[model samples]
Target: MDLSMMIEAVVVLSSGLRLTLTLTILALATGFVISVPLAFVRAFARPALSLSVLAYTYVFRGTPMLVQLFLVYYGLGQIEAVRTSIFWVVLRDPFWCALLTFSLNSAAHTTEILCRGLQSVPKGMTEAAATLGLKRFQIARLVTFPIALRISLPAYGNEVVSMIKGSSLASTVTLLEVTGMARQMVSTTFAPYEIFIVAGAIYLLLTSVVVKAIRFLERHLATDGSRRQRRGSRLAPALPDAGVTTP
Candidate 1:
């Protein structure tokens, strides 16, 4: 590739990086909002509610994000009422549609991750919270969520890394994000390997940042002491009548 092509590719990819980060942050932040409540619901709700969430998770997780993005963008365009309504203003933009799809997709995964964290909590804590006159919501808000979060940090970090990479799919819907710009550069410069390598490097950088952030959170939570006990404790299976006692 010529130096001019390299310069142009850098400029375009830099412009694209902003949209990529925007989509990543918007999806992750909003997905966390959806995930926290859904995690609680999955942990404490009846079988029907839990089953419904399981189904929702299956649909989002099992499908390719590319299909979901198309369904949100082009499928919504097919409705005459949607086209004529105020919602059309937002839906007409691929950016908004991609954001909606990514957010919903991440939410499903985070719900499952946080739900497992909640399950890891020893049963004693919930009963102790109840004896202290804590309401269900209060227990969840003050105690359960914080502990579950600390427990789930590693999994959630993986989700964030996945999210950064997933935002590249937004390019298929006409948003000129990093991967999109890379493809545009490739088409014009006939340097597919160069542009693809650059794009891959950018994704690697993003994933590394996510890993560091999760490590920071792990240290912060460990400062509370309970996390150490939780970490060190062996999760042995229940015994029928062996009379074994945990020290």
Candidate 2:
């Protein structure tokens, strides 16, 4: 292993870090926004609505992300209507094409993760809320969604990590992300082993940071729940003596 070559790879690869992070963050943010409503539709809406969401998720999840990227970046341009359309300007850009593909793919997986979280909410809790006269939307907003979000956090974190790694695929569309830079350098220097190892290390570091953040969030949520429970216990009214007789 050439030590200097490895160091150079790190520096070169670092140039692409911003693009890599940009793609990952934007894709995840957009996906989360899109998935939240879709998840609700999938989990709580009528069969017609739910099945539509299910089909969307199924197609994206069933296909390889690389194929999706190719379809968006290459296949779309093949259509005369697409080329003549107002959206052509945005679709023609490789960066936007990659981002669109990644966001849709992430949204599909996130919808399923959130749907499972929503379904896992205890029936009794929602029922109790209803018995207290809470409206459906209010119960979902105040009780169900919050709990479901916490339940979904760990799984969502895994998705975040996956997106970080998957962002490397953007290189296929000529986006100069980390892996793209690594490939460029390898072609010039004929040192794939060193460059790729550095790229792998960068991905590992990003994932490690995500995992640590997820664990911290889980612990914080647990602490908050315990505190709320203790506060509730303290605020409860004291019962009158059980053995006391009425005058």
Candidate 3:
């Protein structure tokens, strides 16, 4: 491998990093917004509402994101209603289609993560809140969501990293993201090995940042737990064991 050529390839790929980050940020932000309500439905809503969200999550999670991107980008254009509607302007662009697909796919996975967290929240905690005269909404907002969010943080971080890697699929729809730029550079330079390694390194760096950030957040939250345990230990009295007398 020529070191100079590899450096050039890295430079070119860096130019596309903005688009890559754009897709990842927008998709994750939209997905988080969408997942909150759906997760609530899955965790606490009525059967009818929960089942609808379950079906949505099942289909999106079951299918490949690439196929979903294709359907949104190409299939939508084929429909008469889509062609004539105001949304046509948005759907006509590859960027928006990719965003829509990525957002929906991320939302599906995020819903499952958050739903599991919500379900894992101890029933006694909420009951105790109610015993203190907290309203349903107040209990959920104050007691349930805070605990569930802490439980889900690690999984949500994984989802963010996955979306960062998955954003490469945006290349298929003609968006020149990092992987897309690398593919273009390889086609021109006829050196796929060097170009792809650089691309992989960039993704690795991005995921490392995400992992470290999540770990920091986890440790930050753990401090509170440690303090509570210490406080409880200080106030609680020690118990004595009965000694047996032998004849």
Q: Write one digit per residue (lDDT tens) for candidate 1, span 59-159.
A: 99999989999999999999999999999999998889999999999999999999999999878888899999999889888888887888898899999
The runs of at least 3 residues in candidate 3 whose Cα sits more than 4 Å from the true structure, single-residue gaps closed, are 228-247
| TM-score of each predicted structure versus truth | 0.86, 0.97, 0.92
lDDT (Cα atoms) of all candidates against the true structure: 0.88, 0.97, 0.95
State the lDDT of candidate 3 residue by residue for 1-247, as single tens digits: 7888889988999999999999999999999999988899999999999999999999999999999999999999999999999999999999999999999999999999999999999999999999999999899889998899999999999999999999999999989999999988988999998899899999999999999999999999999899999999999997655685556
Residue clash pairs of candidate 1: none
Across 150-178, the per-residue lDDT of candidate 2 in tens digits comes to 99999999999999999999999888999
Question: For this target, which candidate reaches the highest TM-score against the unseen true structure?
Answer: 2
Write down the lDDT that model 1 would get: 0.88
Number of colliding residue pairs in each model:
0, 0, 0
Best by lDDT: 2
Q: Report how far off residue 71 is in candidate 2 (Å).
A: 0.5
